[model samples]
Target: MPNFPNIILFAIPFFILAMLVELFVTAKQHIKSYEMKDSFSSLTMGLGNVLLGFVSKALVLWAFLYVYDHFRLATIPIIWWSFVLIFFADDISYYWFHRVSHTCRLFWASHVVHHSSKHYNLSTALRQTWSGSFYSFIFWIWMPLLGFHPAMIMLQMSISLLYQFWIHTETIDKMPKWFEAIMNTPSHHRVHHGSNPLYLDRNHAGILIIWDKIFGTFQLELKDEKVVYGLVKNINTFNPIKIAFIEWIYLFKDVLTGKKSIKNRILYLIKPPGWSHDGTGKISNDLRNEWLIKKKTYDTK
Candidate 1:
Protein backbone atom coordinates (compact mmCIF):
# COMPACT_ATOMS: atom_id res chain seq x y z
CA MET A 1 0.00 0.00 0.00
CA PRO A 2 2.55 2.53 -1.00
CA ASN A 3 1.50 6.15 -1.47
CA PHE A 4 1.09 7.24 -5.08
CA PRO A 5 0.97 10.97 -5.80
CA ASN A 6 -2.11 12.00 -7.75
CA ILE A 7 -0.52 12.40 -11.18
CA ILE A 8 -3.71 13.70 -12.77
CA LEU A 9 -4.05 16.47 -10.17
CA PHE A 10 -0.44 17.54 -10.71
CA ALA A 11 -1.11 17.74 -14.47
CA ILE A 12 -4.09 20.12 -14.34
CA PRO A 13 -2.03 23.24 -15.00
CA PHE A 14 -0.47 21.54 -18.02
CA PHE A 15 -3.94 20.60 -19.26
CA ILE A 16 -5.21 24.16 -19.01
CA LEU A 17 -2.08 25.61 -20.64
CA ALA A 18 -2.26 23.09 -23.47
CA MET A 19 -5.93 23.84 -24.10
CA LEU A 20 -5.25 27.59 -24.15
CA VAL A 21 -2.42 27.09 -26.64
CA GLU A 22 -4.64 24.86 -28.79
CA LEU A 23 -7.40 27.44 -28.71
CA PHE A 24 -5.04 30.10 -29.95
CA VAL A 25 -3.47 27.89 -32.64
CA THR A 26 -6.73 26.53 -34.02
CA ALA A 27 -8.08 30.09 -34.23
CA LYS A 28 -4.98 31.07 -36.18
CA GLN A 29 -5.63 28.22 -38.63
CA HIS A 30 -9.32 29.25 -38.91
CA ILE A 31 -10.40 25.99 -37.34
CA LYS A 32 -13.54 26.34 -35.22
CA SER A 33 -12.24 23.97 -32.59
CA TYR A 34 -13.96 25.44 -29.55
CA GLU A 35 -17.45 26.77 -29.08
CA MET A 36 -17.77 28.58 -25.79
CA LYS A 37 -20.81 26.65 -24.58
CA ASP A 38 -19.45 23.25 -25.59
CA SER A 39 -16.03 23.93 -24.11
CA PHE A 40 -17.59 25.26 -20.91
CA SER A 41 -19.77 22.16 -20.65
CA SER A 42 -16.71 19.98 -21.06
CA LEU A 43 -14.84 21.80 -18.34
CA THR A 44 -17.81 21.46 -16.00
CA MET A 45 -18.06 17.75 -16.64
CA GLY A 46 -14.34 17.37 -15.93
CA LEU A 47 -14.75 19.21 -12.65
CA GLY A 48 -17.68 16.98 -11.70
CA ASN A 49 -15.61 13.92 -12.55
CA VAL A 50 -12.83 15.09 -10.26
CA LEU A 51 -15.25 15.75 -7.42
CA LEU A 52 -16.99 12.39 -7.88
CA GLY A 53 -13.65 10.64 -7.91
CA PHE A 54 -13.26 11.39 -4.23
CA VAL A 55 -16.00 8.89 -3.44
CA SER A 56 -15.49 6.51 -6.37
CA LYS A 57 -11.74 6.27 -5.93
CA ALA A 58 -12.11 5.16 -2.35
CA LEU A 59 -14.23 2.23 -3.44
CA VAL A 60 -11.82 1.38 -6.22
CA LEU A 61 -8.85 1.46 -3.86
CA TRP A 62 -10.69 -0.69 -1.36
CA ALA A 63 -11.49 -3.24 -4.02
CA PHE A 64 -7.88 -3.35 -5.19
CA LEU A 65 -6.56 -3.67 -1.66
CA TYR A 66 -9.04 -6.43 -0.86
CA VAL A 67 -7.90 -8.44 -3.85
CA TYR A 68 -4.26 -7.83 -3.07
CA ASP A 69 -4.66 -8.84 0.55
CA HIS A 70 -6.72 -11.97 -0.06
CA PHE A 71 -5.88 -13.33 -3.50
CA ARG A 72 -2.59 -11.97 -4.85
CA LEU A 73 -0.62 -14.74 -6.52
CA ALA A 74 2.74 -13.16 -5.66
CA THR A 75 3.98 -9.87 -4.31
CA ILE A 76 5.41 -7.80 -7.18
CA PRO A 77 8.03 -5.33 -5.99
CA ILE A 78 7.89 -1.72 -7.16
CA ILE A 79 10.92 -1.96 -9.36
CA TRP A 80 11.44 -0.16 -12.68
CA TRP A 81 10.61 -3.30 -14.67
CA SER A 82 7.34 -3.67 -12.78
CA PHE A 83 6.36 -0.24 -14.09
CA VAL A 84 6.97 -1.40 -17.67
CA LEU A 85 4.95 -4.58 -17.17
CA ILE A 86 2.07 -2.70 -15.52
CA PHE A 87 2.04 -0.16 -18.34
CA PHE A 88 1.20 -2.85 -20.87
CA ALA A 89 -1.12 -4.76 -18.55
CA ASP A 90 -3.07 -1.65 -17.60
CA ASP A 91 -3.25 -0.53 -21.24
CA ILE A 92 -4.58 -3.85 -22.54
CA SER A 93 -7.11 -3.84 -19.74
CA TYR A 94 -8.10 -0.32 -20.81
CA TYR A 95 -8.52 -1.50 -24.40
CA TRP A 96 -11.02 -4.13 -23.37
CA PHE A 97 -12.80 -1.81 -20.97
CA HIS A 98 -13.14 0.81 -23.67
CA ARG A 99 -14.18 -1.77 -26.28
CA VAL A 100 -16.85 -3.12 -23.97
CA SER A 101 -18.06 0.39 -23.22
CA HIS A 102 -18.74 0.95 -26.90
CA THR A 103 -20.43 -2.42 -27.50
CA CYS A 104 -22.56 -2.75 -24.37
CA ARG A 105 -25.39 -0.42 -23.47
CA LEU A 106 -24.81 -0.55 -19.72
CA PHE A 107 -21.24 0.65 -19.85
CA TRP A 108 -21.96 2.93 -22.79
CA ALA A 109 -24.47 4.81 -20.65
CA SER A 110 -21.56 6.21 -18.69
CA HIS A 111 -19.02 6.44 -21.51
CA VAL A 112 -21.36 8.28 -23.85
CA VAL A 113 -20.74 11.48 -21.88
CA HIS A 114 -17.25 11.73 -23.35
CA HIS A 115 -18.60 11.46 -26.90
CA SER A 116 -21.52 13.82 -26.31
CA SER A 117 -19.54 16.83 -27.45
CA LYS A 118 -19.75 17.48 -31.18
CA HIS A 119 -16.37 19.21 -31.25
CA TYR A 120 -12.98 17.54 -30.99
CA ASN A 121 -10.24 19.60 -29.39
CA LEU A 122 -8.03 19.57 -26.34
CA SER A 123 -11.12 20.57 -24.36
CA THR A 124 -12.87 17.44 -25.54
CA ALA A 125 -10.20 15.54 -23.64
CA LEU A 126 -11.57 17.12 -20.48
CA ARG A 127 -15.07 15.94 -21.42
CA GLN A 128 -14.75 12.94 -19.18
CA THR A 129 -17.42 10.65 -17.74
CA TRP A 130 -18.60 11.57 -14.27
CA SER A 131 -19.91 8.06 -13.58
CA GLY A 132 -17.33 5.77 -15.22
CA SER A 133 -15.06 5.64 -12.19
CA PHE A 134 -17.66 3.77 -10.17
CA TYR A 135 -17.72 0.59 -12.26
CA SER A 136 -14.93 0.99 -14.80
CA PHE A 137 -12.40 0.13 -12.11
CA ILE A 138 -13.69 -3.43 -12.27
CA PHE A 139 -11.75 -3.80 -15.50
CA TRP A 140 -8.48 -3.24 -13.62
CA ILE A 141 -9.28 -5.29 -10.51
CA TRP A 142 -7.55 -8.34 -11.96
CA MET A 143 -4.22 -6.53 -11.86
CA PRO A 144 -4.28 -6.47 -8.08
CA LEU A 145 -5.09 -10.19 -7.86
CA LEU A 146 -2.25 -10.83 -10.30
CA GLY A 147 0.10 -9.43 -7.65
CA PHE A 148 0.85 -5.97 -9.00
CA HIS A 149 0.79 -3.42 -6.21
CA PRO A 150 -2.35 -1.29 -6.18
CA ALA A 151 -0.33 1.93 -6.09
CA MET A 152 1.74 0.88 -9.11
CA ILE A 153 -1.35 -0.18 -11.05
CA MET A 154 -3.01 3.15 -10.28
CA LEU A 155 0.12 5.07 -11.32
CA GLN A 156 0.28 3.31 -14.68
CA MET A 157 -3.41 3.99 -15.17
CA SER A 158 -2.82 7.71 -14.61
CA ILE A 159 0.07 7.70 -17.07
CA SER A 160 -2.18 6.09 -19.66
CA LEU A 161 -4.82 8.73 -19.00
CA LEU A 162 -2.27 11.52 -19.43
CA TYR A 163 -0.93 10.00 -22.65
CA GLN A 164 -4.45 9.86 -24.05
CA PHE A 165 -5.24 13.54 -23.34
CA TRP A 166 -2.97 14.98 -26.03
CA ILE A 167 -4.35 12.70 -28.71
CA HIS A 168 -7.79 14.29 -28.35
CA THR A 169 -6.82 17.34 -30.41
CA GLU A 170 -6.67 18.09 -34.15
CA THR A 171 -3.61 20.35 -33.88
CA ILE A 172 -1.11 17.58 -34.54
CA ASP A 173 -1.69 15.45 -37.60
CA LYS A 174 0.14 12.17 -38.22
CA MET A 175 3.24 11.34 -36.28
CA PRO A 176 6.40 9.72 -37.71
CA LYS A 177 5.64 6.43 -39.44
CA TRP A 178 7.24 4.20 -36.82
CA PHE A 179 5.64 6.15 -33.97
CA GLU A 180 2.22 6.06 -35.64
CA ALA A 181 2.60 2.35 -36.16
CA ILE A 182 3.27 1.69 -32.46
CA MET A 183 1.63 4.51 -30.52
CA ASN A 184 -1.82 6.08 -30.44
CA THR A 185 -1.44 9.49 -32.03
CA PRO A 186 -3.97 12.23 -32.79
CA SER A 187 -4.70 10.67 -36.17
CA HIS A 188 -5.60 7.32 -34.63
CA HIS A 189 -7.65 8.90 -31.85
CA ARG A 190 -9.50 11.21 -34.25
CA VAL A 191 -11.05 8.11 -35.74
CA HIS A 192 -12.05 6.98 -32.26
CA HIS A 193 -13.94 10.25 -31.69
CA GLY A 194 -15.56 10.31 -35.11
CA SER A 195 -19.24 9.62 -35.63
CA ASN A 196 -18.49 8.28 -39.12
CA PRO A 197 -19.62 4.72 -39.78
CA LEU A 198 -16.18 3.31 -40.48
CA TYR A 199 -14.74 4.94 -37.37
CA LEU A 200 -17.35 3.82 -34.85
CA ASP A 201 -16.11 1.51 -32.11
CA ARG A 202 -12.63 1.43 -33.61
CA ASN A 203 -9.16 2.25 -32.24
CA HIS A 204 -9.76 1.44 -28.58
CA ALA A 205 -6.15 2.04 -27.63
CA GLY A 206 -4.69 3.64 -24.53
CA ILE A 207 -0.97 4.35 -25.04
CA LEU A 208 -0.36 1.89 -27.90
CA ILE A 209 -2.21 1.51 -31.18
CA ILE A 210 -0.86 -2.02 -31.64
CA TRP A 211 -3.71 -3.58 -29.66
CA ASP A 212 -6.32 -2.30 -32.13
CA LYS A 213 -4.18 -3.43 -35.04
CA ILE A 214 -3.80 -6.88 -33.53
CA PHE A 215 -7.48 -7.15 -32.56
CA GLY A 216 -8.89 -6.06 -35.95
CA THR A 217 -10.51 -2.94 -34.50
CA PHE A 218 -8.14 -0.50 -36.21
CA GLN A 219 -9.56 2.00 -38.71
CA LEU A 220 -7.15 4.46 -40.23
CA GLU A 221 -8.26 8.08 -40.51
CA LEU A 222 -9.15 8.68 -44.16
CA LYS A 223 -7.98 11.79 -45.96
CA ASP A 224 -11.00 11.74 -48.28
CA GLU A 225 -13.54 11.28 -45.51
CA LYS A 226 -12.92 13.77 -42.75
CA VAL A 227 -13.72 12.75 -39.18
CA VAL A 228 -17.03 14.07 -37.80
CA TYR A 229 -16.91 14.11 -34.07
CA GLY A 230 -19.73 13.14 -31.64
CA LEU A 231 -22.36 10.43 -31.26
CA VAL A 232 -24.26 8.97 -34.21
CA LYS A 233 -27.35 10.83 -32.95
CA ASN A 234 -25.99 13.97 -31.37
CA ILE A 235 -27.73 15.22 -28.21
CA ASN A 236 -27.18 18.82 -29.40
CA THR A 237 -27.01 20.48 -26.03
CA PHE A 238 -24.37 22.16 -23.88
CA ASN A 239 -26.05 21.56 -20.54
CA PRO A 240 -23.51 19.74 -18.42
CA ILE A 241 -26.12 17.82 -16.43
CA LYS A 242 -27.91 16.75 -19.57
CA ILE A 243 -24.65 15.74 -21.24
CA ALA A 244 -23.58 13.68 -18.26
CA PHE A 245 -26.79 11.68 -17.76
CA ILE A 246 -28.76 11.79 -21.00
CA GLU A 247 -27.67 8.40 -22.23
CA TRP A 248 -28.59 6.78 -18.96
CA ILE A 249 -32.01 8.41 -19.22
CA TYR A 250 -32.47 7.14 -22.74
CA LEU A 251 -31.24 3.66 -21.80
CA PHE A 252 -33.62 3.27 -18.88
CA LYS A 253 -36.55 4.72 -20.83
CA ASP A 254 -36.06 2.12 -23.53
CA VAL A 255 -35.74 -0.65 -20.99
CA LEU A 256 -38.74 0.34 -18.91
CA THR A 257 -41.35 1.67 -21.37
CA GLY A 258 -40.97 -0.73 -24.27
CA LYS A 259 -43.79 -3.17 -24.93
CA LYS A 260 -41.32 -5.98 -25.51
CA SER A 261 -41.01 -9.09 -23.38
CA ILE A 262 -38.81 -9.46 -20.30
CA LYS A 263 -36.05 -11.01 -22.36
CA ASN A 264 -36.04 -8.12 -24.80
CA ARG A 265 -36.08 -5.65 -21.91
CA ILE A 266 -33.01 -7.40 -20.50
CA LEU A 267 -31.49 -7.24 -23.94
CA TYR A 268 -32.07 -3.50 -23.96
CA LEU A 269 -29.78 -3.22 -20.97
CA ILE A 270 -27.07 -5.69 -22.05
CA LYS A 271 -27.07 -5.39 -25.84
CA PRO A 272 -24.97 -2.95 -27.83
CA PRO A 273 -26.07 0.62 -28.40
CA GLY A 274 -28.40 0.92 -31.41
CA TRP A 275 -29.31 -2.72 -30.81
CA SER A 276 -33.01 -3.43 -31.17
CA HIS A 277 -34.50 -6.81 -30.43
CA ASP A 278 -36.60 -6.52 -33.59
CA GLY A 279 -33.49 -6.43 -35.81
CA THR A 280 -34.17 -2.88 -36.96
CA GLY A 281 -31.47 -1.04 -35.05
CA LYS A 282 -28.03 -0.80 -36.63
CA ILE A 283 -24.85 -1.12 -34.60
CA SER A 284 -21.36 -0.13 -35.67
CA ASN A 285 -20.66 -3.34 -37.61
CA ASP A 286 -23.95 -2.97 -39.45
CA LEU A 287 -23.19 0.61 -40.48
CA ARG A 288 -19.62 -0.23 -41.42
CA ASN A 289 -20.75 -3.16 -43.56
CA GLU A 290 -23.33 -0.98 -45.33
CA TRP A 291 -20.65 1.64 -46.01
CA LEU A 292 -18.28 -1.01 -47.31
CA ILE A 293 -20.90 -2.49 -49.61
CA LYS A 294 -21.81 0.92 -51.01
CA LYS A 295 -18.15 1.69 -51.52
CA LYS A 296 -17.61 -1.65 -53.27
CA THR A 297 -20.57 -1.12 -55.61
CA TYR A 298 -19.45 2.42 -56.45
CA ASP A 299 -15.91 1.21 -57.11
CA THR A 300 -17.15 -1.52 -59.42
CA LYS A 301 -19.35 0.92 -61.36
Candidate 2:
Protein backbone atom coordinates (compact mmCIF):
# COMPACT_ATOMS: atom_id res chain seq x y z
CA MET A 1 0.00 0.00 0.00
CA PRO A 2 3.02 2.31 -0.36
CA ASN A 3 2.79 3.41 3.25
CA PHE A 4 -0.84 4.54 3.36
CA PRO A 5 -0.15 6.91 6.24
CA ASN A 6 2.21 8.81 3.93
CA ILE A 7 -0.60 8.83 1.41
CA ILE A 8 -2.98 10.24 4.03
CA LEU A 9 -0.34 12.79 5.03
CA PHE A 10 -0.97 14.38 1.65
CA ALA A 11 -4.57 14.92 2.77
CA ILE A 12 -3.56 16.55 6.05
CA PRO A 13 -3.45 20.03 4.58
CA PHE A 14 -6.80 19.54 2.92
CA PHE A 15 -8.22 18.13 6.16
CA ILE A 16 -7.09 21.22 8.04
CA LEU A 17 -8.43 23.47 5.31
CA ALA A 18 -11.78 21.70 5.46
CA MET A 19 -11.87 22.08 9.23
CA LEU A 20 -11.09 25.79 8.93
CA VAL A 21 -13.89 26.25 6.42
CA GLU A 22 -16.27 24.36 8.65
CA LEU A 23 -15.29 26.49 11.62
CA PHE A 24 -15.72 29.67 9.60
CA VAL A 25 -19.11 28.65 8.24
CA THR A 26 -20.38 27.58 11.63
CA ALA A 27 -19.18 30.84 13.20
CA LYS A 28 -20.83 32.92 10.50
CA GLN A 29 -24.08 31.03 10.95
CA HIS A 30 -23.95 31.66 14.74
CA ILE A 31 -23.57 28.02 15.70
CA LYS A 32 -21.99 26.96 18.95
CA SER A 33 -20.03 23.92 17.87
CA TYR A 34 -16.27 24.14 18.31
CA GLU A 35 -14.70 24.70 21.68
CA MET A 36 -11.11 25.94 21.64
CA LYS A 37 -9.63 23.53 24.20
CA ASP A 38 -11.54 20.52 22.97
CA SER A 39 -10.54 21.22 19.37
CA PHE A 40 -6.90 21.57 20.36
CA SER A 41 -7.07 18.29 22.26
CA SER A 42 -8.60 16.60 19.23
CA LEU A 43 -5.80 17.92 17.08
CA THR A 44 -3.25 16.55 19.53
CA MET A 45 -4.89 13.15 19.36
CA GLY A 46 -4.77 13.23 15.54
CA LEU A 47 -1.15 14.19 15.58
CA GLY A 48 -0.36 11.38 17.98
CA ASN A 49 -2.32 8.91 15.89
CA VAL A 50 -0.47 9.83 12.71
CA LEU A 51 2.89 9.66 14.44
CA LEU A 52 2.09 6.27 15.97
CA GLY A 53 0.89 5.00 12.61
CA PHE A 54 4.41 5.42 11.25
CA VAL A 55 5.72 2.71 13.59
CA SER A 56 2.67 0.43 13.93
CA LYS A 57 1.24 0.34 10.40
CA ALA A 58 4.12 -1.81 9.19
CA LEU A 59 3.07 -4.68 11.47
CA VAL A 60 -0.41 -4.68 9.97
CA LEU A 61 0.97 -4.66 6.42
CA TRP A 62 3.46 -7.41 7.25
CA ALA A 63 0.80 -9.67 8.75
CA PHE A 64 -1.64 -9.17 5.88
CA LEU A 65 1.05 -9.83 3.26
CA TYR A 66 2.24 -12.92 5.10
CA VAL A 67 -1.26 -14.35 4.95
CA TYR A 68 -1.67 -13.40 1.28
CA ASP A 69 1.72 -14.89 0.43
CA HIS A 70 1.20 -18.31 1.99
CA PHE A 71 -2.49 -18.96 2.44
CA ARG A 72 -4.54 -17.04 -0.12
CA LEU A 73 -7.49 -19.17 -1.25
CA ALA A 74 -7.95 -17.52 -4.63
CA THR A 75 -6.01 -14.76 -6.27
CA ILE A 76 -8.32 -11.78 -6.59
CA PRO A 77 -7.03 -9.52 -9.33
CA ILE A 78 -6.62 -5.80 -8.96
CA ILE A 79 -8.98 -4.02 -11.33
CA TRP A 80 -11.82 -1.52 -11.43
CA TRP A 81 -14.47 -4.06 -10.56
CA SER A 82 -12.19 -5.50 -7.89
CA PHE A 83 -12.22 -2.19 -6.05
CA VAL A 84 -16.01 -2.25 -6.06
CA LEU A 85 -16.04 -5.79 -4.71
CA ILE A 86 -13.42 -5.00 -2.10
CA PHE A 87 -15.27 -1.85 -1.15
CA PHE A 88 -18.16 -3.82 0.22
CA ALA A 89 -15.91 -6.57 1.51
CA ASP A 90 -13.64 -4.13 3.27
CA ASP A 91 -16.62 -2.24 4.66
CA ILE A 92 -18.09 -5.46 6.02
CA SER A 93 -14.76 -6.13 7.72
CA TYR A 94 -14.88 -2.63 9.16
CA TYR A 95 -18.42 -3.09 10.41
CA TRP A 96 -17.50 -6.15 12.44
CA PHE A 97 -14.22 -4.63 13.62
CA HIS A 98 -16.04 -1.51 14.84
CA ARG A 99 -18.80 -3.56 16.44
CA VAL A 100 -16.32 -5.72 18.29
CA SER A 101 -14.47 -2.64 19.45
CA HIS A 102 -17.62 -1.53 21.22
CA THR A 103 -18.55 -4.90 22.71
CA CYS A 104 -15.15 -6.26 23.75
CA ARG A 105 -13.19 -4.47 26.44
CA LEU A 106 -9.83 -5.56 24.99
CA PHE A 107 -10.42 -3.53 21.82
CA TRP A 108 -12.53 -0.86 23.45
CA ALA A 109 -9.50 0.10 25.57
CA SER A 110 -8.00 1.49 22.38
CA HIS A 111 -11.21 2.44 20.56
CA VAL A 112 -12.56 4.56 23.40
CA VAL A 113 -9.94 7.25 22.81
CA HIS A 114 -11.83 8.38 19.75
CA HIS A 115 -14.93 8.83 21.90
CA SER A 116 -13.17 10.74 24.69
CA SER A 117 -13.91 14.07 23.07
CA LYS A 118 -17.03 15.85 24.25
CA HIS A 119 -17.39 17.81 21.03
CA TYR A 120 -18.27 16.33 17.66
CA ASN A 121 -16.95 18.36 14.75
CA LEU A 122 -14.52 18.02 11.85
CA SER A 123 -11.75 17.96 14.42
CA THR A 124 -13.46 15.22 16.39
CA ALA A 125 -13.10 12.93 13.41
CA LEU A 126 -9.35 13.46 13.61
CA ARG A 127 -9.37 12.38 17.24
CA GLN A 128 -8.63 8.79 16.30
CA THR A 129 -6.85 6.04 18.25
CA TRP A 130 -3.15 5.77 18.87
CA SER A 131 -3.43 2.12 19.88
CA GLY A 132 -6.15 1.19 17.38
CA SER A 133 -3.62 0.55 14.62
CA PHE A 134 -2.15 -2.36 16.56
CA TYR A 135 -5.15 -4.60 17.24
CA SER A 136 -7.89 -3.52 14.81
CA PHE A 137 -6.02 -4.84 11.76
CA ILE A 138 -6.58 -8.42 12.97
CA PHE A 139 -10.13 -8.13 11.68
CA TRP A 140 -8.87 -7.64 8.10
CA ILE A 141 -6.44 -10.57 8.00
CA TRP A 142 -9.16 -12.70 6.43
CA MET A 143 -9.43 -10.37 3.44
CA PRO A 144 -5.89 -11.11 2.31
CA LEU A 145 -6.33 -14.79 3.14
CA LEU A 146 -9.48 -14.84 1.04
CA GLY A 147 -7.22 -13.95 -1.96
CA PHE A 148 -7.38 -10.16 -1.81
CA HIS A 149 -3.88 -8.72 -1.92
CA PRO A 150 -2.55 -6.95 1.15
CA ALA A 151 -2.01 -3.86 -0.95
CA MET A 152 -5.61 -3.87 -2.13
CA ILE A 153 -6.89 -4.42 1.40
CA MET A 154 -4.82 -1.50 2.67
CA LEU A 155 -6.08 0.70 -0.16
CA GLN A 156 -9.70 -0.04 0.66
CA MET A 157 -9.11 0.51 4.39
CA SER A 158 -7.57 3.89 3.69
CA ILE A 159 -10.41 4.82 1.41
CA SER A 160 -12.92 3.93 4.11
CA LEU A 161 -10.99 6.00 6.66
CA LEU A 162 -10.91 8.95 4.27
CA TYR A 163 -14.61 8.59 3.50
CA GLN A 164 -15.38 8.63 7.26
CA PHE A 165 -13.54 11.90 7.97
CA TRP A 166 -16.23 14.34 6.89
CA ILE A 167 -19.05 12.56 8.67
CA HIS A 168 -17.92 13.66 12.15
CA THR A 169 -19.80 16.90 12.33
CA GLU A 170 -22.89 18.62 13.74
CA THR A 171 -23.08 21.31 11.06
CA ILE A 172 -24.63 19.13 8.35
CA ASP A 173 -27.48 17.69 10.35
CA LYS A 174 -28.98 15.17 7.93
CA MET A 175 -28.25 14.36 4.35
CA PRO A 176 -31.10 13.44 1.99
CA LYS A 177 -32.97 10.55 3.60
CA TRP A 178 -31.98 8.28 0.74
CA PHE A 179 -28.30 9.17 1.04
CA GLU A 180 -28.49 8.71 4.79
CA ALA A 181 -30.11 5.32 4.29
CA ILE A 182 -27.31 3.92 2.13
CA MET A 183 -24.25 5.88 3.24
CA ASN A 184 -22.89 6.89 6.58
CA THR A 185 -23.69 10.55 7.08
CA PRO A 186 -22.88 13.14 9.74
CA SER A 187 -26.20 12.27 11.36
CA HIS A 188 -25.25 8.61 11.61
CA HIS A 189 -21.80 9.43 12.96
CA ARG A 190 -23.13 11.86 15.56
CA VAL A 191 -25.16 9.04 17.00
CA HIS A 192 -22.05 6.88 17.19
CA HIS A 193 -20.44 9.57 19.30
CA GLY A 194 -23.51 9.99 21.48
CA SER A 195 -23.54 8.68 25.04
CA ASN A 196 -27.32 8.56 25.32
CA PRO A 197 -28.95 5.25 26.22
CA LEU A 198 -30.59 4.89 22.82
CA TYR A 199 -27.50 5.96 20.87
CA LEU A 200 -24.71 4.11 22.63
CA ASP A 201 -22.84 1.87 20.20
CA ARG A 202 -25.75 2.21 17.77
CA ASN A 203 -24.07 3.36 14.54
CA HIS A 204 -20.68 1.71 14.00
CA ALA A 205 -20.44 2.03 10.23
CA GLY A 206 -17.13 2.90 8.60
CA ILE A 207 -18.34 4.09 5.18
CA LEU A 208 -21.72 2.52 4.42
CA ILE A 209 -24.54 2.69 6.94
CA ILE A 210 -26.12 -0.48 5.55
CA TRP A 211 -23.96 -2.74 7.69
CA ASP A 212 -25.46 -1.32 10.86
CA LYS A 213 -29.00 -1.75 9.52
CA ILE A 214 -28.29 -5.33 8.54
CA PHE A 215 -26.63 -6.13 11.86
CA GLY A 216 -29.43 -4.56 13.97
CA THR A 217 -27.12 -1.95 15.54
CA PHE A 218 -28.60 1.04 13.74
CA GLN A 219 -30.52 3.74 15.63
CA LEU A 220 -32.27 6.75 14.15
CA GLU A 221 -31.69 10.25 15.42
CA LEU A 222 -34.96 11.38 16.94
CA LYS A 223 -36.05 15.01 16.92
CA ASP A 224 -37.55 14.62 20.38
CA GLU A 225 -34.25 13.57 21.97
CA LYS A 226 -31.26 15.68 21.02
CA VAL A 227 -28.03 13.66 20.96
CA VAL A 228 -25.68 14.15 23.89
CA TYR A 229 -22.06 13.57 22.95
CA GLY A 230 -19.21 11.93 25.00
CA LEU A 231 -19.05 8.81 27.13
CA VAL A 232 -21.55 8.33 29.95
CA LYS A 233 -18.62 8.76 32.31
CA ASN A 234 -16.64 11.48 30.59
CA ILE A 235 -12.87 11.60 31.03
CA ASN A 236 -12.39 15.31 31.61
CA THR A 237 -8.67 15.40 30.88
CA PHE A 238 -7.06 16.67 27.69
CA ASN A 239 -3.72 14.92 28.22
CA PRO A 240 -3.11 12.86 25.09
CA ILE A 241 -1.51 9.94 26.94
CA LYS A 242 -4.33 9.70 29.43
CA ILE A 243 -6.90 9.98 26.68
CA ALA A 244 -5.18 7.30 24.63
CA PHE A 245 -3.94 4.81 27.24
CA ILE A 246 -6.05 5.40 30.32
CA GLU A 247 -8.42 2.60 29.44
CA TRP A 248 -5.54 0.17 29.10
CA ILE A 249 -4.29 1.14 32.51
CA TYR A 250 -7.76 0.76 33.98
CA LEU A 251 -8.22 -2.62 32.31
CA PHE A 252 -5.02 -3.98 33.79
CA LYS A 253 -5.84 -2.53 37.16
CA ASP A 254 -9.18 -4.29 37.21
CA VAL A 255 -7.67 -7.57 36.11
CA LEU A 256 -4.89 -7.38 38.65
CA THR A 257 -6.58 -6.28 41.84
CA GLY A 258 -10.36 -6.50 41.59
CA LYS A 259 -10.58 -9.24 44.25
CA LYS A 260 -11.91 -11.83 41.85
CA SER A 261 -10.71 -15.32 40.91
CA ILE A 262 -7.97 -15.53 38.30
CA LYS A 263 -10.49 -16.63 35.69
CA ASN A 264 -12.92 -13.77 36.22
CA ARG A 265 -10.05 -11.33 36.56
CA ILE A 266 -8.72 -12.42 33.18
CA LEU A 267 -12.25 -12.29 31.85
CA TYR A 268 -12.25 -8.58 32.56
CA LEU A 269 -10.09 -8.15 29.47
CA ILE A 270 -12.29 -10.41 27.36
CA LYS A 271 -15.72 -9.32 28.54
CA PRO A 272 -17.73 -6.27 27.53
CA PRO A 273 -16.83 -2.94 29.04
CA GLY A 274 -18.69 -2.10 32.27
CA TRP A 275 -19.15 -5.79 33.03
CA SER A 276 -18.60 -6.56 36.70
CA HIS A 277 -18.65 -9.72 38.75
CA ASP A 278 -20.50 -7.79 41.42
CA GLY A 279 -23.23 -6.63 39.08
CA THR A 280 -22.33 -2.95 38.97
CA GLY A 281 -21.32 -1.82 35.49
CA LYS A 282 -23.82 -2.14 32.64
CA ILE A 283 -23.24 -2.85 28.98
CA SER A 284 -24.75 -0.63 26.26
CA ASN A 285 -27.54 -3.12 25.54
CA ASP A 286 -28.45 -3.34 29.19
CA LEU A 287 -28.75 0.44 29.43
CA ARG A 288 -30.75 0.66 26.20
CA ASN A 289 -33.13 -2.13 27.25
CA GLU A 290 -33.78 -0.40 30.57
CA TRP A 291 -34.39 2.89 28.79
CA LEU A 292 -36.89 1.26 26.40
CA ILE A 293 -38.90 -0.31 29.24
CA LYS A 294 -39.04 3.01 31.10
CA LYS A 295 -40.12 4.89 27.99
CA LYS A 296 -42.82 2.32 27.26
CA THR A 297 -44.19 2.42 30.81
CA TYR A 298 -44.20 6.25 30.88
CA ASP A 299 -46.13 6.37 27.61
CA THR A 300 -48.75 3.89 28.87
CA LYS A 301 -49.03 5.68 32.22
lDDT of each: 0.93, 0.89
> Model 2 Cα displacement at 16 (Å)?
0.5
TM-score of each: 0.98, 0.96
Question: What tens digits encode model 1's per-residue C-alpha lDDT throughout 1-301?
Answer: 5788999999999999999999999999999989999999999999999899889888888899999999999998999898889988999999999999999999999999999988999888889998889999999999999999888887888899999999998889889999999999999999999999989999999999999999999989999989999999999999999998999999999899958999999999889999998899999889989999999999999
> Which residue pairs collide, candidate 1?
none
User: What TM-score does structure 2 among the candidates reach?
Assistant: 0.96
The TM-score leader among the candidates is: 1
The deviation in Å at residue 6 for candidate 2 is: 4.3
Whole-model lDDT for model 2 versus the true structure? 0.89
RMSD of 2: 1.5
